[model samples]
Target: MSVGKSVRLFLSEGTPGGLITAEIMNWTGHVVAAPRSDLAKLTKRPEASRTGIYLLLGEDPDSVGGMVAYIGEGDDVSRRLYQHSRPEEQGGKDFWERAILLTSKDSNLTKAHARYLESRFIALATEAKRARLVNGTAPGQQPLPESDISDMEYFISQAQIVLPVLGVNIFRTTKPAKKSISPVTEVAAESGTESPIFEIVSKKHGIHAQAREIDGEFTVLEGSMVRKQWISTAAHTYEQLVPKLKQTGVVVDSDDGQTARFTQDYVFASPSAAAAVVHGRTANGRTEWRIPNGGINFGQWQTLGVENEPDTD
Candidate 1:
């Protein structure tokens, strides 16, 4: 059973889309989030004056996942945001439409702590492959005492939990995708049972793929053979769909270049998105995916699942 943790959120401006604050009970970390339009409102907050690491996020039309983010740290959280408000040609990022800042409410976060957190966030984001990162290069780890490292690691765990509740998903990933953000989630996989498996087998186009839903997200498992490339360049075919997956190392071309193989388990928002990538053109995933041996399509299985399911309180 999943245990519940209480997270308190406050709408600083009395509106859901405006300035917001998020915090967990017994946690010293404080989160302040706001849209680019609410910069003035965020700057006035006391947390902005403290040392912290932050994320600047925006859309990436070219990204297969359609999100881009920059992770940075600053001694004065407000100062760095101000600098990034300028034009890109003038040494500022113009891509972001929102910002999420993480500072200590107890004023215990130092510049070193922030830098360490920044490095971990960058590494975790890259490893997850859930979004495109704008950072140019990775930074070497900053040396910190053993105790501080342990405490900061705990801080990151709490941040991971709070971030998702606030709608930041860059830190989230499906478990089968190994080498993931370890500090981002602490839940252990339950014993004695496992999720049902789904597969796609086709002899004509020579495809053999396997996927299953995990925690409400559909996950395409690793080592699955998929279409090497989109067969059509028609109007319905999206540009660079499979190429972007390759670019992120989620899937790679086979030695013969005939089919692609997934390097790791990858999550898709829905069965349709997974099917679209597998077959290489716009696809109706519900019909393309199915159960093995008995041969039931995903749509039918989904409908049948509700027949005798247990209820939640």
Candidate 2:
């Protein structure tokens, strides 16, 4: 189990949608997040001058639900930020509308350290695939002393913990059994028994999944099987999702090359997404997944709890 962390976020502008500074208890790293509209005010802060790595975020114009990001490092974070704030014709970045600056409160990060962090952050964001990386080339790593390398790794770990708090999910992966964030483990259960397992089966398409609702996300347990191919009537969402899942290894070919399987626990934004992937077509997950013993589907179970069962037609 991951230990809980205490993160303190101070809103400098005294509003929910303004400049914010965040720090984890007992850690030297600090994160300052601000909107593109407040760049001038943000650049004036003291942390702006520190050596650090930064992230530029914006919505991707090409795809729905897609984000664009760019990662960079500098000896003077403020100067680099100012340069990027200019128009693209003026040699500035134009794809991002928000900036997240990561710096050390103790000013411990050196030029080499910042470069090393930048290289790793880019690689990580690429792996997460949560956003489109606007970088034209990879920022290669820099050599550091062995001791300093270890210290920087710890700093990276702290950043991983704090970034999610700032809504930076570029490093989060869905494969972990329990997410490092504040994941909900418990589900609606009986008075004394554990949360009952639920399933969605489609013998025709060869789908058999075990899942549970946790923190509003439909989490399909590890080892779930998905259709190898979408049916002819599959929706456009299914067409796009399956290929991306295969690319991400959430859907992988069987050893026999006949079907695909989920290698680890995967969480979907909604039940419909999980169902669509499972059935190889559009689905109504609320009515599709059921408790074999109680004969109640997810929709009723979630609203009425374990004591009540849906009336069968």
Highest lDDT, which number?
Answer: 1
Encode model 1's per-residue lDDT on 1-313: one tens digit a residue: 4445579999987998998999977778999999999998787789998999999999997786789999999999899999998899989999999999999999999989998999998988887777789998878899999978977887887787788788888986666322212233554323122257888887777789999887567889999988898876775534366888888788899886688989998888788878877877777788889889878888877787475666776
lDDT of each: 0.83, 0.77
| Most TM-score-accurate candidate | 1
**Model 2 ranges with Cα > 4 A deviation:** 61-65, 175-199, 208-267, 284-313
Query: Model 2: what TM-score?
Result: 0.74
Tens-place lDDT per residue, model 2, 1-313, is 3355678999999996899999977778899999999999989999999999999999974432267898999999999999999999999998888999999999989999999999988887766667788889997888999878877876776787678778887776543323222112322211111234678876765678888764344777778887787765635665677777777666787775555788766667677778887877788888888887658888888777465576888
| Model 2: lDDT to the true structure | 0.77
Q: Candidate 1, residue 187: CA error in Å?
A: 11
What TM-score should be assigned to candidate 1?
0.84
Question: What CA root-mean-square deviation does each model show from the true structure?
Answer: 4.4, 7.1
Query: Where does candidate 1 stray beyond 4 Å?
Result: 176-194, 232-234, 237-240, 295-297, 300-313
